[model samples]
Target: MTTMNKLNQVILSATLALAASGASAQMRIEISGVGSNQIPVAVAGFADENIAPQQISAIIKADLERSGAFKLIDAGVITSMSNIDYGTWKAKGADALVVGTVAKSAAGDYEVRYKLFDTVKQSELSQLNVSRAPQFTRLTAHNIADDVYLKLTGIRGAFSTRIAYVKEYDKRHYELLVADADGDGEQMALRSNEPIISPSWSPDGTKVAYVSFEQKKPVVYVQNLITRARTVIANEKGSNSSPVWAQTGNKLAVSLSKDGHTQIYTVNADGGNLKRVSNSAGIDSEANFAPDGSIYFMSDRSGGPQIYRMNGDGGEAKRVTFTGNYNISPRVSADGKTLAYISRRDGNYQLYVMDLASGQEQRLSDSTDDQYPSFAPNGKYIMYATQAGGRKSLAVVSVDGRVKQRLTTQAGNIKEPTWGPFMQ
Candidate 1:
């Protein structure tokens, strides 16, 4: 009995004016950029007792090469630092060289120090200092890698976030899955027979609010990982789906048909008296709360589904999209600077992002049937559902249309990947 809607206009506004001027357009390093420049580079492990220098070397080598900024030299081909010949690398067209060492502290922490050298200038490019516990070596490697990329290119790395998505094992069963930002470390929670949809994280990242059909009705439930306890937030007789948590953590904005029609409504996190936000009577669902409390939602009152925004109290709703015939599943970015949605192009649907300030729209993702694009807490990456070869799965892409990585272990299909609020 979970709120049932085959397809409702879920906040697919192509508004949000994105500024053309990039703050770091002339920057050096990047979180995601090309791995094609192929700057020939050589790196060797420094002496270490706590762990193998070779292990840390592998991490740095992979990260640099992944950036497409450098051509990583094979470990076997690396020359000794005693040789001290920059010409060998320079002659081999090496742009830079990296050398590092690892040490274990008495307290059991591993410390790694690395230096990036400019082969052409015969000078040091950057120095990175990193420390991590023995059990957290991978995290340390990620940080070290970020240090190197930032020192060289100047963009912050996003290797520490998580993506939440719905994975269907069968037509009647689905589970919410959490994976690494790169789609690693996947874990499942809350399995059910009816359709599960719209997993939204709290701003603090501790708990999650999603719609599940365990009771044979679409009901919004807020689940806490730390406690392994869940309380029903919305379980109306009709469709009660798409639960979005408000900024205060004590409230939620959700779509309900309890009043005989679907519209945006607000309720306490524990599920009580619903404060209806939209009363158009058309189809106002998928309410996403921006930072300032302005609710962004999808409504077809204008005849076709379009994006609209209004205050939390439900006054002065403004239309945001005038370009597409069909736009739905609008997700406002963490910073409320961008809106991501599934827009129909030609005959297929693709993910699109619009700057709320400028109303400029940019098409992203190549998946023909993509849906439910949500932003990470940092507003850098987006995860959504995509169909390929008639099979459904989850995928993520950068907002700029540069980097993309697909994540799923779906036995059947996957949908609605959302970045939970940052875990405090």
Candidate 2:
């Protein structure tokens, strides 16, 4: 199938362990090629009698700053709109200003009201009222950041989304982790002594499908995030790997070798309704669903491992890659207009993106061993795993190959990152 380190040879059994909440080591982001046209904005601390204004404003500022899209102005002197000096902010090169207030409600909850103002036009662009439980303080801040981002950029923000990945703790210990988009709020969703790989998030972001070798063979399992319970979906006669969720979240496209040759199959999320999807004699695996519901996968049907596209029911299979001899791990964007994949060029595996409309391909990563490209829900960035300094870590890059940042962990190697869908 789509070439992966065979872990079935190793045999070890271990139970899952719960790690502390949040990232063990917050990911340090490095920015590059941040465009000069960055929108300068000022975020004022929310006025509240009890809540710490800096605590809420920091999250919003960090979210905007890390995106490489906006530059934050010094708003330490401005706390609420009642004292906002729009002329001074505009003179300080701010295009927009965000001011807000947080107040405790009679029901013991918190209500946050924020306004986005266009400094140039001297008019308010948008206002938001968010009511949230006290325990969801961080989440409430992220929600405000999302709203501010959408109001200014006109595109949905993925700050509220989570990411799934595999964390290695020595040779025999591994854990599947789910973390915030900024690499914080990490939680151990699944743990095993055997190897774990290919953690895929369901479209609804409530479950994760992954391949585990705990039973001495590569088996696919879908685990519920809330209950921490799992259902063995593809533990048939042979190896099962590369489980990818369909857009509907009710089905998954996986690669199985039960019939002696690796091929793609679709199975219900609840472990029933098994149906073969690809009939190619050659190996077909790593199937990902496009926005339009078509399946794009990797196969060697043309004598080399290349990307292929086919219908959801496994008919009319067609080749999608021509320039490279080795191109695998095809991930279509949320919009289905762009395809991101890994290509082996000059003996180096790197990330590349293809514009399906113009039949154009552009290399997006410079790392030699970059793999497992997952597109952000907004389709503006792609996150993938790469080896650096002899350690595997996750990195994110803009679709255009600029604005790159790396996320590393202090625990161990990080791999197989899958960006979760937009929050419901």
Candidate 3:
């Protein structure tokens, strides 16, 4: 989540091997596991590489492995592509082949060309094309890999998407940053020596709304992504934070304390016409919208943070979750079939996704700690942050919990990973 977006630029650069040149930049979750079945495949090195100094194969291998797909073959463990080539890969259990070439353009730009070959059929399967952008050519490998992923897997690749997260380098200070989904090219959106928390993305994916303490107290501000321009969206005398964008694309369901208790309120994106949604005395802070025009939230009025559902129009909320001791962060999936949240299981905090209809609960992780799960635009995956082995990291898991992927590097502690709107 921390480097989720910035690393999209240099996912396949050799610099990652050195673990340098990406302090503020992004890289992907480097996982060490082979797929259930290693497909027979070989990736030839790029011939005309650029100044990246490190080769791109390692990064590519990491992405493939993290997906729990494709088995990478070691070069030393194999012979040349031509010498024993005809059926060598297929015999070695390689079902595919990948080859690439890199070069510096006459205009001083970087370019990479890659091809995916189906070894079983002995023919090229697809072509993954990538062109570099300003100061971001290094991310070419991720784009290429993503293209290959979509073509082969029939799912939209997230290689080009961005991730929004909060970084608390100091215990009391925090900064809201956006980076590549793989944790490269991290840049600050807002920084405060005071505590900052909870970032929500606009429907247009062009701006972010987050709670900041830049003025010595907590306040919510809608920040422009391109211009870095920000204006106060909601700032009350009491606790005012935890914003969730509405389906209408203009209204934000936020919790305000200017009244007395932190109840749900609806206000314009520019901060005006505050209408109360919840009038309860207990906490109603974490709330998100569902696709079917209902609001799902957490409330301790039931003695614990039980899940509650209410209509888009303000009314009495109906409690939905009954089997949980603790539940917060109600994330409505794009399809609205499953609800993802953080809950306590076996005395540890873990990510949980529940079947909205059957109320069946499933824990998606077993780690030191996990928090803040945001669903991908397609609803196929959920991205969350985790801490394990005394290290902070970001991870992505498939909806059914079959595939779990760590998507961040060892750069900084990543918190609050909010997925962006569909980019297609």
Candidate 4:
């Protein structure tokens, strides 16, 4: 279910406090399907990679394969970029090839170099040389993958970005986890015996704002990722949840029930200057910002939950969704050309994407229970929460709905995934 539902059904009744702890479960990606047109690429092993802390070639392969945009062909020990193996790769059904080298300096720094080749065209597409400490081996690989993906697809890649989500170990234990975009390298930002929901990343990616049931009421808190410090941003008399950052990163639009009904309110990031944005008597929550600074949210003013759009500072609202009687969790694409949300049909909640200009909508998920649709930073894919085999898990699908994959942790159920911004 969406955060708005949780706020009404469970926020007032749950009771617990948050504690800091280290995250334990490692998430694994399982590709359930692939796109009809996939670029077959072979990523060769990097020379002298043993000196690094992580395998650069394997990480790149996993990143690309997980995207469902590339078909991985085994390179089989080829590591040198100097050799002209274009004909060999082309005959082996690889349209493109990647090769690189890794060197460790005496002072413990590392130099990572990689080159992308077009086997059919028999030419080098791009190359880069990066220097970083040993701890950034995986990140270096992700950067290389991003470059390769962008060069081939003409769209920027989101491999180097991060993601935030909620993990529920049990009814008594809950955690807010930050991890890589691929769902690995997780760190627990906040842990509680109660519930935590609506994890939203700031535009600059330095902090996160979320609702915590720490004091037995849903209160909004902002936590710095670098220092692990948290501050209460909203703690009104009633429920305070569904905190989403504005594009400028200086303000947050949150759902508050202080007015007797949940409504959208814009508050300063430091918890000052609270101002109401929506004046509707009906329930209004799940506020999302579009690229142009307009706010898209869910409101039941029309007798059923539907998405509505209003200006940034509480103007007249115009309904954007009319096809479904139930629609919530309105997430806008980075370009503002598409909107991804959950719509109920045939007694099942599924992920749906709509073209803002044409009003054409398409169903993107085959599962019965899907929620929390988060777009990749590149806007080519969406990562959402869904139920698989009765276990809550994360799923990613291409914006075209041609590709799909399921991401599951080793131990617990994961939900409310918010994909972070691209690294500056």
Best by lDDT: 4
Q: Estimate each model's TM-score.
A: 0.76, 0.91, 0.82, 0.93
- Mind giving the per-residue lDDT tens digits that candidate 4 earns over 307-370? 9999999989999999979999999999999999999999899999999999999999999999
- Candidates in order: C-alpha RMSD to true structure: 10.9, 7.1, 5.5, 7.1
Residues 60-118 of candidate 2 have per-residue lDDT tens digits of 88888878778888776355666556798899999999887788888877777777889
Query: In terms of TM-score, which candidate is strongest?
Result: 4
Q: Which portions of model 3 show Cα errors greater than 4 Å?
A: 1-41, 51-57, 74-88, 128-130, 387-395, 400-413
lDDT of each: 0.69, 0.82, 0.71, 0.87
Q: Total clashing residue pairs per candidate? A: 27, 2, 26, 0
Off by over 4 Å in 1: 1-135, 148-155, 408-410, 421-424
Residue 289's lDDT within candidate 3 is 91
lDDT of 1 by residue, 1-424 (tens): 1111111001001000111111111101224454434456766655562264337666566556544556666534233344456887788766667766677878867776666777788887667565554644544555556555555556544454455677776587676765445454455656667788889877666667998877778889998755558888988779998898888888999898998889888999878877887989599988888888898889999988988999988997999888878888888887789998888879889999999889999998876888888886657667778888877876667677766666545356777788755433
After superposing candidate 2, which stretches have Cα over 4 Å from the reference? Answer: 1-23, 48-54, 104-108
Instruction: Score candidate 3 by TM-score against the native.
Output: 0.82
